[model samples]
Target: MTSSLFEPEPGKDKEASSASMPPALKLSLEMGPLVIFFVANFFGQWLIDHVPLFSSFEKPIFPATALFMIAIISSLATSWILARRVLVMPLVSGVFVLIFGSLTLWLQDATFVKIKPTITSVLFALILFGGLLFKKSLLGYVFDSAFQLDAEGWRKLTFRWAFFFLFLALVNEIIWRNFSDDFWTNFHVLASTIFTFIFLATQMPMIMRHSLEQPPSDKNEDHAD
Candidate 1:
């Protein structure tokens, strides 16, 4: 099963089972808003010029941000309507989008909107590290439904994810501050998504090694008894 932005902690919400959508649909729901945001930014000027519908805004970025904000909200609403519950990460990301997106529109400064991803990444990194300090494997809570790993596996996986988030935060800061707006927006959608999928793929071995499957011997013994 594909993991959601907010994974239900194990044993916490029975209702999540019925609420969950198919994995492919869930991934689409998660990625759709970002894809829209990227397209809006990439083609904002053309949209403004060619589409009378988008001409009301003074600048391309303004309308793009507005559309992006609406997309985020719409995505979240759809998730809730379909799943009956929100995942943690998407919910956090959606809140930041609404906040910074509103600020960007009101202040007419894209800087606020650009910093939202950095803020979210850093916040996720901090939460993971803080959980580690307390000897809690919070990442397990996020992935427990997908992978039943041993304690050490969970710890290692959590550590890896914590560092990965920190790296993403730093990368976002660098790209947005040093690059053109168009470049940054494109990178935000593409690079981050690619890196995340790659990271998850690289963890397959560790996940298999720590999986909670019973041995053949154990199954045979149980059957004999």
Candidate 2:
């Protein structure tokens, strides 16, 4: 096919500049904040106790909350440095983390931090499903760099992902609400990862089948060079 869809971008050496990294690395980078949040929670109390101003937050969960905000800030700063663009979704998430995390510390209650996953999950599901109602491939926008798909394919894949997100939100809510904090944390980490991997595997066939076989039109190719 004589198409420019696969052609290198002009004026930019994508292969050298930033394209050398694989999709999984890019995704992990985007998930930096969540990862940091988890790590901070595990060691935040001790870290906070060391900081003079935060020494008042020396209480277990209180210190954790302070450290969580610090991690969120660190994540956002790194994202801005690497991407050089404002990531809307993660920015929203960081804002929530700062706000609710601070509240958790102020109130000395763990409920605020516990609610984060539920809120983020429900918000994600609602946004995804709402896009489906409008016949838009919302997932395409989020995952555009990871994979390519035709219109119909993107729509179908998006709808399925949207429903899956809703299901995940329900699962998070139930576990956090009814279980001990330690058990809920374990489920959030290990169980959620397993669930996501399985779901992605199940969608592979559909993704391959629906992807566009032909490249995009050369006429639409950018002439940035």
Candidate 3:
């Protein structure tokens, strides 16, 4: 029995080690970096005024981009520490954050950070569609075994998500390119969250129809008998 720094202890159950963290903690780990980015952007001027180091930046978004990069790295590290593994989607997004966020800071341009979401969304859409070419529902792999569904269900769901990602990419491009920075920031924090929730809610019927897990109600009825 050998183990590395990240590996579960010899006596620990592998499933337990990889099991999802508590919902509240998981949500915090995932959303905390975004909240930090929003806050940093909103308070950039204040930071620049007080923090002598930030005096070089003319706009808030650049500082925001730097903080975003740091926050995202911290978030991913925390997630890995807690869950023993980082989820695929956040890891992918974090990689882009580092890349584009660094480009934003290094070049002293906001466009890189602003277009990060659009690029990431498009990449995800491409990955999903590419998987479908080989008859694979890559979304399942991306989601880290969250649930199971029939093959047809996976194909349908994958198609829905691929198109949804493309739609999100389009929306991101429109907002960031056509709107004020503050407006785009607000849309990123608020509207994107709402849109994702709405999209997931819309998919509940399909998820229920194809869910491999038995319903609680069915288990209750069986117990009664």
**Cα-based lDDT for every prediction:** 0.78, 0.64, 0.77
Residue lDDT tens for model 1, 1-225 = 564555566545535643575556666777888888888887889888888877766666777888888887887788777776575667788899999999998887889988999999899888889988998878865576567666767877898999999999999999999998888888899999999989999987766666667453433343211
Please give the range of 10 consecutive residues that has the lowest summed lDDT in model 1: 216-225
Q: Per-residue lDDT tens digits of candidate 3, residues 1-225? A: 433333332224445544645546656777888899899999999887888878888898878878888888888788677776665677788999999988888888888888999999999999989989998787765432444565666777888999999999999999999998888988998899899889988987776666657564533343211
Shift of residue 43 alpha carbon in model 2, Å: 3.2
Q: Please write out the lDDT profile of model 2 over residues 1-225, one tens digit for every residue.
A: 232222123222344324543456456655665555556556656667676766766455556566667766775565556544334466666787788887887787778877887788778778878877887666764555555666766777778877787788789888888997656656776687789889989887666665565444632342321
Task: Count clashing residue pairs in model 2.
Answer: 0
**C-alpha RMSD for every candidate:** 6.1, 8.3, 5.7
Error of 1 at 40 (Å): 1.4
| TM-score of every prediction relative to native | 0.83, 0.75, 0.83
Point out where model 1 deviates above 4 Å: 1-7, 11-19, 50-59, 214-225
lDDT of 2 at 71: 63
lDDT of 1 at 1: 55
| Candidate number of the best lDDT | 1
TM-score of 1: 0.83
